[model samples]
Target: MSDPAGRLNIQLRRTPHGFACDIGSTRPVAASGLFCGRSPAETASLLPLLYSICAKAQASACVGALERACGMDSDPEARRLRQVQVAAETVREHLWRILLDWPVLSGEEPDRQAMIGAQSLVKRIFGAADPNGVLLSPGCEKPTSFRSVLEEAASTLADLMAERVLGLAPDAWMERVETIDAFDDWCRSVETPAARLLVGLRDSGDGRLGHTEASPLPDLDDGTLAAELRGTDAATFVARPCWGGAPRETTPLTRHADSALVSALVADQGRGILARLGAQILETVSLLRAIRTGELDGDSTAPSDAVLPAGVGLGRAEAARGLLVHLAEVDRGRVVEYRILAPTEWNFHPDGVLASALATLPDAEETILRRRVQLLVMAIDPCVAFDLVIP
Candidate 1:
């Protein structure tokens, strides 16, 4: 003696927050007249459509969720290790520029196509660096001077990844797997770009300040944000402990959709001939890092629930460049009721453009501006394939 129709009374509307989904309604609100209709394929498309750049991740989230829903076992944790391995390779492969290749490419960054050359660089040198895997630190009955060994290892293989970029076989560097036994004999090790860089340096005693070996953490040595991260979470990798007690008072973003706002911030005319491809490189690596490490959780776009909405929904997924978030709502569920915020929105937010007046601010040194800006953009982690840089 129950109304079967009540079970079908599900509502999806374009509220001010995000895609407003009202299912399991206790009160009869005439769902037939106000139902938010979407095809099954449309619903499926929503997941990947929002995160195509990190197709691996998009697929991971979808397949993982679907498998769980269907009671199918993917053993996500088992695959976690291998996924991280692939992630490392993909992150390097996704970079738009090779900063190191800068010196070789006539003091300029290499174009995006050479991105594979970059990740291959990291993989060739660190393929065996995974905690449960092998590395080529040969002939060590008892080993010491980890730095010296790291430097020798990095440089030797860097030369090889570089050659592969030019379409050469890396048989020379590819043969290091033979020494995995000797290297594993040493104490447990961790991986990071800076640590890897130190491993690459050739006999530079008392490694550079940015060299990761000197730090408490291995991952904090390279890129734009390394300096600021010297004593902070942003500086540390996910593998490290996050200090400062639960990120203080994170304000969940709101969905404020004015097509004009989104349209205004977007670059028209291509913003052509920009030299800083490092921004794009960081974005790519960050996404790859997300899979190897963990989900870079932040506020996500919500499917606005009328009753006690979760203030901070995490729209966090690592995109090709980095994390992209759209923290807002769909109150009634439509363009007018929704907000669309992109990563570029914050980085390019017009905070008073006295920026154009400075030919160079008298003491204008590049104060990790590029890194900070790139970090901010990467934090959003948009999946849209279009380039986001303006300068």
Candidate 2:
């Protein structure tokens, strides 16, 4: 697999009252321009390779955009298959974070075996759904036993979530959301490795760490997004995505802003480390339920027809992190322009969510502050590698 394109460099300076952070990303910006001039099919085929972190989501968005550009209706079976793949990927990604990164915050060795199991589960789903591994090709025939494969995959994932992450059955854990104190108590007292990490965060004062104002939920419509892509300089829009002249957040919390559990957490704790973590866990459980019940289905903004407008075609999908938007302009069946707005660009904007959180870090020894900052960044979960610089 190709190494990720770029890295996040965070610099911290001690201020009188607290600390100030200057975050910079060397992550390759606007790399989607490479897709220009390719056929929509070709673009969809290559997108997964280029963005392997969220390959399924990228492929979904690419296919959605190209379909819109060509004005073709999505094949229902294909759409359902894609949703299953996306859900599997999302569950796997969240498990990786919980099994691997969460341990780091708690000073525990990562459960490498469990991480490997999670990886294998995702592979099993993909292997069964798209045996040829053509992630973007629509209407590919599935084996007659494909539904059984999905059921097994979902069952395995549910077991992992219950045993490692939640310390309760998925349904039981979800019910605890109605009582935050009971849930918090479980997080602090449960014997599971994941709960141990949460306990560590609480003991280390992360419950209040990285507190800041939550950005308004993203509400950009297709017309607004297309106008911005076509009107603003392409380089500017890709490098710095802003809504109404200000950086906005599009995390799972923002994407599910009205979710009962998410709303309750935000109302109780604001948007701190705890709230962000809660949103992720809640989303994971919800996705698991949807996957098992075959309720994973949704429509995109991509137009459906062969006769599409010559202007930009916009497609958006909620990735494991947040909203991922893709824009393409096709002329005579060839891509003339392409751009992507990833969730990282929104949350890690210089004056954006991550920055706001960093600015709120309380003054402390450099080492302690750096550790706390790292945990906060992990909560945001950028797709690229990052380093923390204290000077």
Top-lDDT structure, candidate number = 2
Clashing pairs in 2: 71-304, 71-305, 72-305
lDDT of 2 by residue, 242-276 (tens): 88789888887786668777776667667888778
Runs with alpha carbons beyond 4 Å of true place in candidate 1: 1-41, 46-94, 99-313, 320-322, 326-341, 352-391
Error of 1 at 281 (Å): 8.0
Q: Which RMSD values do the candidates have, in order?
A: 20.3, 2.7
Best by TM-score: 2
Off by over 4 Å in 2: 1-4, 132-135, 138-145, 300-308
Global lDDT of each model?
A: 0.27, 0.77
Backbone clash count, each prediction separately: 37, 3
